[model samples]
Target: MALEDIPRLGCGRSIDRIWGTIDRPPTAHEEQCDQCQTARTRLRRLSKATRSLRESDLHNPTMEPRPGIKNAIMDVVRAKVRRGSRILLRSADNGTTEISEQALSSLIRSAAAAIPGVHSRRCRIEIRSAAASVADEDHPTGTTGTSTNAGPRLIINLRVAAAPGIVIPRTVEALRHEISNAIPASVGIGAGTVNITVEDLYDV
Candidate 1:
C-alpha cells in the first residue's frame, strides 16, 4: 500500500506508534508496508515541527497560534469527516436546526485553543442515537467511520500539543470543562464525554 491508502491501511494506532505512545512492536506486515513508512515519515515531521515550536516558545513565551491556524485545522477536520451527517438541535419553536459535525467539532477545538499553552490539533466527534447501542467507532483523522443521527448524544475527542511547564492533568481538566460548557451554548446539545489526549509537548 502507498500513502494514498492511509484511510484504508493506516489508522490512529500507527500514529500512536510513531509518537511512542504505543509500546507494542509493529507486525511483519506493518514493518514491510510502504504506507506505514510514509505515515511514519509524515508523523515524524509533525513531531519535529512541534519541537521547533517549543524552541520558538522558549524565546517568546507570549507567542500565539499564527493567523490561519484555526482555518487550517478546520479544513483538515472537514476533509476527514465529510462523509458524516449533520446533527439536529432542538429549537424554541418546536423545530430542529441542523448542525454539521464539523461545526460542533469547531466548538470543541475553540474551547481547547483558548487555553494558554495548548494548541488544539485534531477534534473527533461521535453522535450516538437512542436507537443505537453505542457511539460510532469511526474517528475523523483516524481510520474509523463517522455517523450522525438526530438528537444524538455527542462524544468529543480532542488531540492537542501541551506546552512545557504546564500541568498536564489540570490542562486536560480545563479543556474538558470548557468544551462541555461550550457545546450546549453553541449547538443546544449536551456533551456526553470529552476525551483529551496530549499528543505532543511544546514550549511555553
Candidate 2:
C-alpha cells in the first residue's frame, strides 16, 4: 500500500508504516482510510478517556494510581528491605586487639600509659560495639563494607585527667586521630566516627 494511501495513525504517519514506530505521525492514507480512521478514532477516544481519568484523579484524588505508580511503589518496597551490616577487623600482630568492653578498656589504658605525661591509673576508656550501614558499592574502597572476620563498628570513650597547663583541644584532636587510626588498623573494621571526652582537669 502506498504510504500516503495508508491510514494515518494519530502521530500523522500511515498506520501500516507506523506499526513498528509507535511515535511516528499518522500518514495521509491513514487519515482517510475507513479502517484506519476508525482505529484512530478509537485510539483518540481511549486517549481522551485516559486523560479524563487522570484529571478526575487529580480533582477527586483516589488511591488508585495514574501511570508510573507501579515503579514508585516498587522503589519504596525495595528501600524498606535493603540490608545494613558491619564488618570489623582485628590485628594479629599485637596482642592488644580485643573485642570485649574490658579488652577495649585495657587497650586504651595501655595507649595512655605510652603517652609521656599521661597517668595510666587516672585515664578511663570505655568501648562499645555499634552497628552502622556499609556503604553502597559505588562508594570508594575502605569507605564502607563489613569484614567477615571483624566485628561491628566500635565506639571508644576516653575520659582522662589532664594537667592544668595542658591544651585540651589539641590533646583531644590528637587522641581522636590516633584512636581512629589505631582501632581500624588493629581491628579489621571501618571506624564510623571517633569522639574523645576529657572528663577532668588535674593540677600536676
Candidate 3:
C-alpha cells in the first residue's frame, strides 16, 4: 500500500511497529515512497537536534536586574503622580488675567530661581487647577448663607538642577517640602502635591 493509504502511527504503538516491521535500513519500497522518506528524515533530524540541545548550556547561570531597578521604578511612579496633580490657576476678576501654561511655567521658574542652591535654568514647573465649592459656614445671618467656593486647587511639579556637592535626597526633599508650603501660603489655595525631579548635576 502507498504510504498515504497506510494507517498513521500512534504514540501507543511499539517502537518496532513505529519503525514499521523492517529490521534493516529503508527498503527500496520505503525509500521510493517520497512521503515516508520525508517523515523519516524530519523525525531523525528533530530527535538528534533535541538531544544535542538538551545537553547544551544556553541559559545564564547567574543573571539579574541591577539593584537600582526598584529605585528607578519608584522614581517613575513619583513623576507620574506629580504630573497627575497639576492644576491651572486663573484670576477671578478678569478672564484676561488667565494663567496660561507658559505663565505658570514661568512662575515655577521664578520660584525655583529664588531658592538657594538651585539652578533656575534646569528647573521646570507644571500647574493645573480644579474648582472647589463649599457652603459658607460662618455667615452672621445663620441661614444657609451664601455658599462660596475657592476657584481651584493648584498642583505643581518642579524639577531643579542639583549642584555636584549637594546631598541629593535631602535637597530634593527640602525643595519639595518648601515649594509645597510656599505655594499655598502665597496663592491662598492648598498645594495638592509637589514633585521634585533632579535631572542633571551642575558643577556650580
* Counted clashes in each candidate structure: 2, 30, 6
* Top candidate, metric TM-score: 1
After superposing candidate 1 on the true structure, give the runs of residues whose Cα lies further than 4 Å from its correct spot: 1-84, 91-95, 131-150
Better of 2 and 3 by lDDT: 3
How do the predictions measure up, each by TM-score? Answer: 0.52, 0.38, 0.39
How do the residues 60-151 of candidate 3 rate in per-residue lDDT, one tens digit apiece?
34444576577567545545554443343445655523334344445556566666677643234433334232331355765654433254
lDDT agreement of model 2 with the native: 0.53
Residue-by-residue lDDT tens digits, candidate 1, 72-131: 877786767653668777546877688877777777777877888788877778777734
Lowest summed lDDT over 10 consecutive residues: which window, candidate 1? 4-13
Candidate 2 lDDT over 129-174, as tens digits, reads 4333333225555655553534555545566666677777786666
In candidate 3, position 177 carries an lDDT of: 68
- Cα error, candidate 2, residue 172 (Å): 1.4
Winner by TM-score between candidate 2 and candidate 1 = 1
